[model samples]
Target: MTQDSRPRSPLAMVLLALLAEEPMHAYRMQRLIKTRRKDDVVNVARSNSVYQAIERLLRDGLIEVREKLAADTGPARIVYALTDDGRAALNRWMDAALATPAREFPEFRAVLAVVAITGPDLVADRLAERAEALAATLDVAEREERTSREWGLPRVLLLEHEHLVAVTRAELTWVRGVVDDLRSGALTWDTEEMLASRPPE
Candidate 1:
């Protein structure tokens, strides 16, 4: 899918990811996403979108903005903290994000579409590549967690990091099986049979 077709904003993900931690300043949040967090390794993509995401979150009331007098900047700065409502929403999103893939049903629809497409081998290859990428992403997160733990991030933060890594790994496992099945002739298409099975439509 094109970038536009992707989630219009990583705002939701960004807010939830930050709220996953305690309150932080905008610059700190930006640094957290963009700057090297651990020994020049493991960085979250810190584009201007991170700023935009925070703005949207403030407008949405997902995160409350507190204006504070700053000592270093010589001006008031806004700090963001997750609201109760935000936390509730975060809980819901986390549950959905971490749950098994089929829970979304799109995976199944994609499976059907893969079978529907010609050159199933190519699809299987793509799926395997996707699985590898997903695993690598999760591994990077694991490394981040390890680094963060050593740096003495809050206990809760470390725990959540562990859970997030586990969820990513679980998704990788699911994708691996999907790749295997696609390559193993576990699914197939029979256009004529499907046409016959269909009703008038």
Candidate 2:
């Protein structure tokens, strides 16, 4: 039973983590995720997805309905709490996620792969713009990291943002170098000519 047939959802893991704190209704769960800035990682924009995740978690027996709350002015809400299984699942999921790097297809990399077709100057210009944007993001991440540290947040809680800053900084460095190479005419490509000259594979 440890490995069910149902597929895992990132949102389900998030719900488990939240319920581990205390039982919460779906609406409160969504609100807390947004307020805590967890929406950055999870797509809380889709309320339907949250509801679907709740249903799946309940079905998996990882979470149990704790109680039903009735309000005089609004609809009744069913609160959910993480089961022991949910806690164990959450820990397992988190450990795996932190230990492994999942293969992800970022849009920027996809665009970068085809940028040579756009020619070097335009690609360089676009890359320069992206570098600026990344630098700005890094600046914000640094400030947030400092604030978190001063607020006595533990390194464990701050590591993800720190990793983001480091990755962005490295990307900026690489991008600047690429832009320089492009502007210096060190990187050149003849798309039409190269295609015409291509041999059958």
Candidate 3:
């Protein structure tokens, strides 16, 4: 595939990885992702998302249809397997992902950059809500990790879950601290004065 046409998104990488294991139909791939709780890391909420990624992979020559099996009660199932190029691409993507941090622009960070416009009270209230949500998410991830261990899953399989829990807990703590600072007037800002101080072009 040409550089411009290379499939490099998280979904594309995941679809290739799934094919690396064994040739499977699109429906089975989607089922496996959900069953393994990979949906948290990959966006497969829409059924069409998986098929769309498959199409891109096929177009890029990263994967090919191995066979089509007729079903007794539905459309034929087309099983896909990874191409040689795909295996190379998967390894390359993994290496780059693990060895470097890509610059990402998360919405929360963007909002924080200009948050002073929202005034202290509103920002504090919203961040407080976000902290609650983060706490709940962290709790769920911790529970899931414990359950996975109890079920005898290997540590390698739970690495992502562990990372997620750690990140969520850290975010929750930071957000709570910011909210406390705002409420206690430790982080106050004069919106009118700041806006008035802006330099004219």
Candidate 4:
């Protein structure tokens, strides 16, 4: 099977995750996702986002859109099914991300990509920017979540912002390590001979 085009957004990930099981239409997906989010006050997901994700996935060749047979509700709907490449990529991304506790983050892998090339100063700068951006977004999300009326929220979820905080700190610590490496001149750019002869993991 061909390797699939990588997906970046959470909605893209969610789409692939769901489509791995079976084909689904936009309407059913919206319903299931709404139920999953436990949002009852207002729709956390929009029809446009769902349709846009579908279009993007189709464009990326991760999903195939099939014309559904006529049903009681409306016009012929498009059912999305995962291609062979989609299945393979979804499994690969999941295995890589969920492998081990500390070794399982996509964000860390992304940082490592830069660290392997640009040394530490740039990595630290980028991490600082990211941390600040994520913090501000999280603050807004928390405030909105609290003031908004939503039904069937998890009892403990109201106080679960700690997870985001912890992850942010972990990333910051990694960034600090990168900065220290740069300051101490510990990063070696000469790695071709090392990698060319390295053994398999």
> Which candidate gets the maximum TM-score versus the true structure?
3
**What shift in Å separates residue 152 of candidate 1 from its native position after superposition?**
5.0
Which candidate leads the pack in lDDT?
3
TM-scores, in order shown? 0.51, 0.86, 0.93, 0.45
Q: What's the residue-level lDDT of 194 in candidate 2?
A: 61
Estimate every model's Cα lDDT from 0 to 1. Answer: 0.65, 0.83, 0.89, 0.64
RMSD of candidate 2 to the truth, in angstroms, is: 2.9
lDDT of 4 at 110: 75
Tell me the lDDT of model 2 at 88.
81
Candidate structures ordered by lDDT, highest first: 3, 2, 1, 4
Candidate 1 lDDT tens digits, 76-148: 6677789876776666655554553322445745775545434557767877888888888898998888888
Runs of candidate 4 with Cα error greater than 4 angstroms are: 1-6, 38-44, 99-201
Order the numbered candidates by TM-score, best leading: 3, 2, 1, 4
Model 1 / residue 183 / CA error / Å: 3.4
* Candidate 4 residue 123 C-alpha distance from true site, Å: 26
User: Residue 177 deviation, candidate 3, in Å?
Assistant: 1.0
State residue 150's C-alpha deviation in candidate 4, in Å.
Answer: 21
Backbone clashes in model 4, listed as residue pairs: none
